[model samples]
Target: MTAAVSSAALPALLGPHCTVDPDRLRRYEIPERGEPGKASGLVVPQTEAEVASLLATCSKNGVKLVISAGRTGLVEAQRPDGEVVLSLEKLDQPLSFATPDGEVFRFGERAAPAAHADALAAWWRGIGAPPCEDAVLEVQAGMAVDAVNLLLAPLNLMWPMEMGSSSAASVGGCIANASAGANAVCYGTAAHLAIQAFGYSGDGREVLSDAPAWKAVPEDLLAINSAQPRPEWGLIGTQGVLGVITRAKIRAYAIPGQREAALIPVSDMPAAMRIHAAARALFGDDVEEFEFIGKPALELVRDLKGDAFRSPLARHDAPYYLLLQVKSHKAHIDLAGMLYEFLADAVSLPEDQIGYAPLKALKEIRHSITEASNARMRALGGGRLSFDTATPVAVFGDYLKVLEAELKAEYPDMALIAFGHAGVGGAHLHILGSKDAPVARHAKALVKIVFDVTQDFGGTFSAEHGVGTKWGDEFIARAPAEVRAALIAAKRRHDPAGTLSPRSFALDRQLAG
Candidate 1:
């Protein structure tokens, strides 16, 4: 099929009800600042019939489709230029409270991601938490992370997925990428939290995915101190190539009766490692999040935000910062006391360097790093490449040291910024090059070095982010032939036309096969 469809013809085929203005189409064209590509025209389907009609028209006219929701993704998954772009913006509707299950929320795919948070909060006000055990919320694809949290907060419940872009990311986008942020160390990624996903396949076939993708890992097979694996959840992060996630049944956690955060300063990586080990011993199941902020990252925040950036530790000059959250369901349990005593007895954390801070305050400090890096890049007139990779927790320290050494030797002048969930092995490394350096050239080289090191350490190149076209080729090249073949077959089975996010997952070559 050739990409020859005219924008004007879209209204005739799909009807004016689904057609979008050129101004709106331009907005969807270029989503992120640095991301490549754009879109030609848009079709906003207010009803399921409209969606189906648009799909059928596109299929008949040989027009490709790219499913988009909060378009806040770093990878270019929504590049629909020269194709019929279907926007779910108008499908937003109120929560269906008359459902058979009180725990479930039937949502329209076009619901704004932020609305879920509002809905959950209102629901809690109307009726409290689930009678006995925790409950699940069925959210539509376009709901935002902040909105879900806002609604869930009053009920002493929350959808635990964390991302820097959570405020803007759609629930469907989160499920698509399986984003696991700072809290992923304890709560696991979006893949683990999503119990079921309902979506329309590329060829316009509706589908439900409730079963696990891979077998359960035996307890004996687990690494010495590694977190549990949910292989079945791997199906959640397909980058919207396989299908468009319309609705998802996700688990919500009870709000801890008690919550406290402590910022522990460490001399170096080795000392930081000790604090993580001690956290496991002292907090155990109560540990909610374990985040690390290297000196460089902290300095960036300090410089950008000025005195507004409050450091939990008095001496913000420490080599590394350990941000730990302790939570307890029992209101009577003294979490603060427990953490203090552990610090006193263990001697792993330096006595003078440890300090307590409000959870919200610490989170502000952690989130500011992203803003600082982006500000730096804007000022430097060059783009930055951030790599999210993970190695075994045991080798994470060594991996960090090696990564720093290699990056310094290769790009001596480049700024190195690091922070993320330390409990798990996931690390976020952002590097900004000189103003004169070619953005693409530096990005390519940095990606190669990082991915190579990640592979050598028996880690993954794309940790929480899905392998979009940006990383799709490298991901395919590294996969075993059998695994790659399996992926190809699955793509073909679900999207025979390969019309949705074509070239994603490296499935373009599978058409003839």
Candidate 2:
């Protein structure tokens, strides 16, 4: 391999796009969780051409590049380790909207992109325009998720992939990680929403998903792609190992006209599962979100946020809580009445235990779990273990029960706080230990126990969170032999020099091994 490029030499080679400033480099190194890493330099590319040129230079020189956008990743994918940081923050612009037939709605007419959802909504209402049908938004990968929604709100549409860090999570990062949030049960994951992608391979070759004939294709890209099959939508989950995604066309959905949510106290996981089934049977596709929050997680939020964040239920004694929401785009549908009827007739939940809440309020309580858990971990001053795992919906309840039992039996002292998108059979499980009873010493063993249970329940250890450096070994060990070979081949094919995101999923180490 060629010698790695030095940070000092970057500015001379790439001009103003590259920076060796320590302060800016430090900002790109911070991850949502875990220790920060060190970067040799930071490069902020403003256009697709610049991104292509930068990748070409890095590939030729054997310089590693870690793609960073928003810097809200929890798996340390954005955390550079002596590699150059490619920040896409400056590429935050929504290009346009188009229908399948090629009708385009360019943003050039507007002075700037929509900044607030409320203002956009008011403007859209004033126009009295019908919602755009079969709409797809072509947006820069660096655009924040919330900003995308803000732009869509005016059109009575939404990207629909919701996350707690929507304000900070970028379009490309979500696509790279194939993230599925609370609304995933209805709208599905990023892979499903992203229909097209345009980017550059690690070797600096322009890559594009099959663009319709109406869309203009770069002459050079077309010439280069004459022989190779275009990358499929599955590229959404490659985690940047295959290529760097600069822009994508994401599918949009009509905003629900009527929505209602409720927090129902449950005695245990089984009860939550039963309620979830009842809701699905009652409302079908209208069940937009169903979240599970363990008692410990709920208690943590209350303790951290004080009385203002206390449980809405009259009695906060339930061992678990299920946040259920139903929505429909049809204006005539009585979503509120349906939800109340489901709770009263199907689940038989008592009035006192059923807490009817606004959709925004329910979301606040659900999203606060992560912050509250992090705060509790810091206070304890011990090792922190956070897992994003998923199981088959049929066995989700049993999976949680088995996992919880194993944790209690193996490490009784470690505090457990579990919550996540129950509608999609995914859970965010956290283990916190006090300094006096640190779990760091047995971190490996604890992880093994959890993975084993997940496997037994036909679940994935790395669900929404991609296989960053944190779970690379687990992926290598657990992936089928054919799957490993395919990934290795793709790495060699797209990133021959191992220049882009060499540290992601430890592909560099895997290649060497």
Best by lDDT: 2
Instruction: Report the CA-based lDDT of candidate 1 relative to the real structure.
Output: 0.68
Measured on C-alpha atoms, candidate 2 has an lDDT of 0.79
User: RMSD in angstroms, all models?
Assistant: 4.0, 6.4
lDDT of 2 by residue, 315-388 (tens): 77888899888887777877788778888878887787779977777788899988999899989988789888
Query: Which residue runs does candidate 2 get wrong by more than 4 Å?
Result: 1-3, 99-102, 109-112, 115-129, 210-234
lDDT of 1 by residue, 172-256 (tens): 7777677777776676667666778777766667777772322222222211111121223333666666666666777767777
Candidate 2 residue pairs that clash: none
Error of 2 at 54 (Å): 1.0
- The RMSD (Cα, Å) of candidate 2 is 6.4
Compared with the true structure, all predictions reach lDDT values of 0.68, 0.79
